[model samples]
Target chain A: MEAYNYTDIQCPPPESSEIELCRILYSEDYLTNMGYMRGIMSKNEYSERALALTEKIINVCAAHYTVWEYRYNIIKDGSNHNKIIKDELIWSENIILENPKNYQVWHYRQLLIIELVSKSSDDYNVEKEFELIDKSLIEDSKNYHSWTYRTWLTKHFKLYNDKNLSFINSLLKSDIRNNSAWNFRFFLLVNNPENYIEQDRKSIINGLVLQKELKFTENAIELAPQNQSSWNYLIGIYEKFNLDINNLKGLSLKYSNFEDDKISELEMQPIISSVHALELLARIYSSSKTTVDKAIRAYDLLATKYDPIRVNYWKYLSSSLNTT
Target chain B: MVSLPCSLKVAKDNTAKIYDRNGKYHGKKQYNEGTIDDGELKFHLKKHLNYFRMLLNFLPNAFQSNDPIKMSVIYFNLIGLDLCKGVEEYNNKLFKTKKERSIIIDFIYKHLVESGEGFRGSVNLKLPLVDRSNEMNESLKIVGNYDPANLSQTYFALCILLTLRDESMSQRIDRFQILSYLKRCQLPNGSFKPLLDIYGKPFGENDLRYCLIACSIRKILQIDKIYEIEELKKVDINIENLYEYVLSCTNYEGGFGGEPFDEPQAGLTFCGIAILKLINKLDSKETNSRINYHKLVKWLCQRQIWYNKYNKQELDEGDNGIYDNGGFNGRTNKASDTCYAFWCSASLKLLKLEKLINVKGVELYLLNETQDEILGGFMKNRKSDYCDPLHSCLAVAALKLLDSEYVRELKDIDESLVISKDALNFMEQLKW
Candidate 1:
């Protein structure tokens, strides 16, 4: 199932540019189109030809959206409901395997899932979808379509529980730089109804969730110190907890093997993680007097030596941080 | 199957005059290569204009699959050409002296060439003028059957026409019918859907994008500044509820979503914020709801990811020259795209926090990397060399806002419509 060659579907011919559209749509595309024509023409019959044609188009390209629509219409008119949908789902597995990034194919899967769920909302196994997405994600880890579908499914089926946290943790374990996983983790955590907002003295439930996340993220950051997603998550937790930057000052320093008293020997830094750690430390210390001077030194190093490209940002921080 | 139900001229000869039948602009025009104020870019501004000029006259058959988004492609080209320089520069040896602007304008007016359930002609549902037109109907003789007027296409149609809106262009079509039809797309929830059929079946893809377009249409179609709010209130819609519905789309992340409970996206963020600004609800103190602009500024500033800084962009010589970092990604963890440059930049401009971004860095990523030095169009990203007119149009709009100096005679553009100030003023001048 290679994509269609451009000459196959080019308007006239032979003017192929860099990005090839589908090779001319398959002859099945033209035949399968008959199904859509039958659907739109309101012929309203689940004819074997219509079913076969729809299957051909789907087999050729799972993203053939019109064929899916026509197939759905024909099913709505008449047919074996469960078997047809289950067959389509099984067919989608091959399509998803071939084209993991096809948003349209995933959308078709989602529409089918919704149909199943609507048919028996009370009995629908939400775990099956979670597993399906988990499988799809295994194929293409950072597939935005898979992640968005996960989020939509979670919200749709009320699957936002500790189970999701474990799923995201598994993803992060595989690739510490899986930023989408990190983002999803944050979204799920923040939107959790159980994680109540701080009331009369740091609500214990909220604090526990924050502390658990903070520890979880700190573990990930230790593994891939230069991972921006981890750092963002750490910052998000710090913001969520309304914790002071001074608390993590020592950890940030040691993560880079920076000796506190020997800051004057600043030329020893080489790892990229230390630079981001230092940058975060500076942002946290924007108004702190005790660490302001050391933060300035770190900023100047980041500006001139370490990450010179964003020197404007580091220099701006160095100049402005001390002023406040 | 291209219909000619309306008596408008096709102007095939005129098109040939615009560019010879082969599609070349007929003559080469040199542009000022004066030092780009930043001096950090390795791109040629003049070449972009030339690239676009050629693409417009002789479109590649490769873009035939993009039939649905054809109107969008047209918008991008015309507006990109406009932003890159001026419409005058689009002329050549033949199209040069003979009202070249009229050729482009006529090309746009051609979308209004047919009838449907809601109007005499359903311009386009999702494709271009040549390869598209929802020709699901032609005559009203069939009493009950009629084709639906796609709201998003109609909005793009009016927005494109208003880019060249003059006095008489308003008279050629039924404005009242168009205006009434546009309003019908609004759902009771205050959000606007993208399509409304002839039998009044609503296609329920309500989002900030369509709502922005609907609001822009209302603003563009209004004849008078006086009592405009009063007229809007008179319609069978709740402006207050509509405003509230819009407010719900805002998330705590300092960004907006397509709908309530949706994730934050740069494009819809602009649509949400801009629609509010258009309807004058952005600053209203109705619910004491304050948007954390500072947090939003931080979020948006971070969207400009400089690929050279960290990621490995392994391109060959000539290709090895420019880095693709810091290009705007529409979301938190997405690839940088040409269109996001516009969406992110437009949102920043509307929010008035655009200055926080490194101006020099953005110029390099957008102009050098995504833009095809040869093709004159912008690709969606570095990985895929797939170029499209939408990307080309928005990328130029982003550039115009980044610095107007590169583009001579750049109009003061409104962030909402992304149309020039003069065009917006022209729309204002038109009476119903």
Candidate 2:
């Protein structure tokens, strides 16, 4: 509530279009705060007033990285780092809710958490952070920042456990087609630090973990045969382990019914099959010498019927197979 | 193998009702037969040129909130005009005098950081143009601390320079200082932060978007050639670590995410692939071994929507609408968007696999559904009422990349840079 002097540094002239636009879009308080903050920043005045001004500016323009960076510098230089970081954590929760899509808000939160953890390890509450991220994700389940922050949080705190798995499962349970959750699931399985150890690789590929993931993906595929996420996850698992594509031939055949030997007219419409499954089948067939004809047939069917949207891709695949 | 319940069903009707962004019925149109009326298309082009001109001159009150990224908006407007082959018209009509062009150029230069490293998003934190000797004082160190240049803004600045055919851009830009700034922005984990903080520490989410932009800045500045000049090698970013960072962000689904362990998105995937391509590491054995090339292509191809109204579940989920049959979506189970058409198509184009997708279908989607008939720019989707710079610029770039007969008026665009081929040629021909 104290008026800060801004005589030291020059603000944009009143005639500037930026000032005019700011007048139209923002409040007088926002403009005054920004002008004062510019002076404070130029003078290297990392005071409580400067910090407060940054918060005001950030509230109006959450995407401004300059304001966020200045605020971080203020916090780092402040006497009570832990207290200010905790306050920032709480303050940014509201900012995130107001602008969940803003990358700066999430990045600022990450900075606050890092500072909090470094200053007072006991004060770094992982659950609170998770809750905030969950709320943000609830607003937009596929929010890039929220998901990225969540991943960073989990990895940073070494919280890759059953709880994380269950959270991802709950997301998938709500919407099986949530590719974000599916990608997170893959991350937890393959990219976890614990899984990166030399011995864990074998366990991941040959152990019950792979079996469990396969069954989960299979069930998802069965529920929605056309879901590309499930199909992609399934293919990803096999490809990651360097497993044979033929292993998926049976599951793929269940969804894609096509006869390779039967000669058909170019205009004939095939039975409506899962385009994903057909694509998978084509990959499986194309990989083997004996089934090249089958791969061409599947591509032909996809080009003409099931997935005509990517007909050129299919034809390209078929021709490549023929050349080989 | 037992047959599973087939959830995939094609629409029985060959045609569906067309609607504008406001949901006004525009009569029935056959699926996959989105043709543009030449007269209407030409009118739309005129409107687009007018819109670009307006954006470049002065943004309307509606875009007042976008003050922070005014540089990007200018770049979009310039690129949009170039794509429409309206730069000459723009010059002749709006900015006839050399002084006008110089004024615009000076405005951009005003946003450059005092350190001469990079450009700021805006002049909001404009510092006094102090002399270099005076700036070396301890008290003036805050100049370097505050108003740090952003990677994205720097990229946009260079692109704007190229679009404007600023031949002296190389001289104006401090390539070594920018390269040093880029080096500072890179985290030990290999990802580049979008911006730096007061103490020159890299902050912000590690994203492929920033990575791609960093690569672009490096390419535009010709930083790679600095290695041959021994004096400049110290300023170069650690390309090995950057490459590792990119590879680490790849999802099992064969698409790249914005960050590591994030969901694969078309835009980020484009960023990832484009980074590899820019660095000349895309076709390397290490990259080939790591990336699932076929799967990436499949994922990119599958972005094109083949709408089937009979699929009730898909309809309920808003996966694809009748109006979006030929459009591309960013992710799986997402509705088609105008920008993703460029992201997906350009990613494929970078891989020399552009012909794999139905190019005609993309043209149809852009022309008939997202292209605003009455207004100039392209909308995000059929449901959006107004068009913004991002979607409009990308939509035009996508059309240019496709080189479709429907939009032959559009000039060719460099897929990686997303600028007119002429602009790219100008950049390539610049002698530093």
Candidate 3:
């Protein structure tokens, strides 16, 4: 039980003008501990005490990249990485729960998982990782870090199964406006790990899967007419597959009927139409010479009443259609 | 359309007289007709200048957790000062002498991790220059080996140096090493990590932000020239895959997400488009085919919050507030935020569609709602009382892009770079 000789690093005096609030917020004891840790880190001392100090430092400043880097280095240099990795995983889960929005914690977790997999793939539990990420997502469904990590894990582990799709489906069922879920659905459909080849993915999407997804999206749109996520999903499916917008023309007309008489009175008292449906009808009509006028009328209505915030955009679209 | 409860009267001298609904005088300003409250709206340049100056000197305890990316905070403050046309005056006050200027220059350079070949976010990891040279060779070696340089920090440091007009920046910067660092940070999938581990493995979130920063660093340092040199070819990035990665992030909604299969966001959309513009692939056939260009423009335009009551009712709950009528939101079904004004507008500006949105509406929203009249600096939203550097800098930059009468005093910004046009010109003149 020898005492560790702490180095004396000159910390800025409390009264110094350049002292950042980050430093000022630190207690004297905390600052002293950090100074000692820094002294050890500078000397490249990768010991148990140094490793323990990193934990102490990280608890306070989870976003501190340097401490995370130091901790990773210590674990990398350790003799028993299996034990360290397991312990760190459990430790980081708590840290992540406390700071779900922290960029550094998720990254550190990624590093640890990558390291663990590299050492012994059998020991790496994909289910546990999923549970952790799912818990994080439950806390905040739109958490960008959590979603990104989930996507990365899916691709990395090739966990493209019913579980993944059902998870996304449940998310959508709860909140159809969750664009993140819609985006993930697109990713799952197109970049399914099972279909490694582009041709395979194309064939899969062109099959009954495409019809099912389209129906699901259209139904979601019907439930919430203004929800842009479902509309974007429908549009994404069509554009990515090069499907004709005319296919949705029947559905588009259900929400917006742009007849000659209706177009004439759009300026006086605009009909209550779904903005998305009107835009879709406009896109569909602009494709053919016979219906181009109807497209212009739709754009005019959108510009004047439905979506006046983007009047210039609608006007630009109408003008472009005219030139074509 | 709901008319504002105000009217404008123009005089012979181009000065506008603003009156309330009752025709009582409100204020007078040098204004143009048709612009919303151009006569009464104020830029509050002096107040914003003081705000930036104060932030530069010291950030409050509220920013305690942001200690790691201190360079970026400095970058935001410096850019804000530049936007306010206060950089020269502030520099004169802070760095009155050559020695003082060199001290700052030296301080920034100290963050450079020699072994990592990039700049660390802060100087906390590395010992002081005197200590490193005299008594801490072992510590210095460890710091050099273990200290990771961040992509964003590297970008921020380079920009700060350029803003300071550091003549020797090109010479002082180790271009080859930094390029090597960038090369190491790139993943096999063409996305980039913000930092590398001690083992030289890129480990961090792979997002559009890092990709954008990586591209910016490459452009600023002119790393493409490395390919001309036989030995330096290893430092070059995979431009083809990088382009593919950026295009892959394009959402069906026409905006981009942080990563592929993520929700399209205004900030990431800007980064994605800016990356393409920087790499000269914006108009490539692949880009034209991969992206729905018209849909992207429509999506960006859709970000503007309108004053219409019907549209407000249709929008997400809690977004019915009238104060955000002209501001832009980062995503669909989201409330308007101060930064998205710059993000969406700049994205449109890059697409050559700046005129597609109502610039007057944006100006009015920033001035009347988000701009903190008493404190200076812009808030995140109308309801926010606090103003930070990010929102304030972006609000000003967004205004500068509009080149409206309200922002006539502010210097123009290069939309893609988000730096003042004059500063960009100065950077272009540098030897690097």
User: Candidate 3 — which residues are off by over 4 angstroms?
Assistant: A1-33, A76-80, A118-124, A190-193, A196-207, A260-270, B1-40, B114-116, B128-144, B224-234, B307-313, B316-323, B383-385
Q: Identify the superior model by DockQ, candidate 2 or candidate 3.
A: 2
Give the DockQ (2 decimals) of all models. Answer: 0.10, 0.40, 0.31
Give the runs in model 2 whose Cα sits over 4 Å from its true position: A1-31, A121-123, A196-206, A259-270, B1-43, B128-143, B309-313, B317-319
Range of the 10 consecutive residues with the lowest summed lDDT in candidate 3 chain B: B8-17
**Least accurate 10 contiguous residues by lDDT in model 2 chain B:** B1-10
- Model 1 residue B114 CA deviation (Å) reads 7.5
Q: What's the DockQ of model 1?
A: 0.10
lDDT of 2 by residue, B177-229 (tens): 89889999999878899877765678677788889999999988877655688
The sequence of per-residue lDDT tens digits that candidate 3 reaches over residues A1-324 is: 344545554433222223231122435555666666566666566887777778777776666676788888889878877888888899999999999988889988988988898896465677679788879888677787888898888888877767888989898887777777887888888545456345646766657677888889889877777677778788888877888889999888876655533554323333544688889999989999998998999899888766776778889999998887
Residue pairs in collision within model 3: none
TM-score of each: 0.73, 0.89, 0.86
lDDT of 1 by residue, B398-424 (tens): 877776344544555777877777677
Docking class of 3: acceptable
Return the candidate ranking by lDDT, descending.
2, 3, 1
Best by DockQ: 2
Give lDDT per model, in order: 0.57, 0.76, 0.76
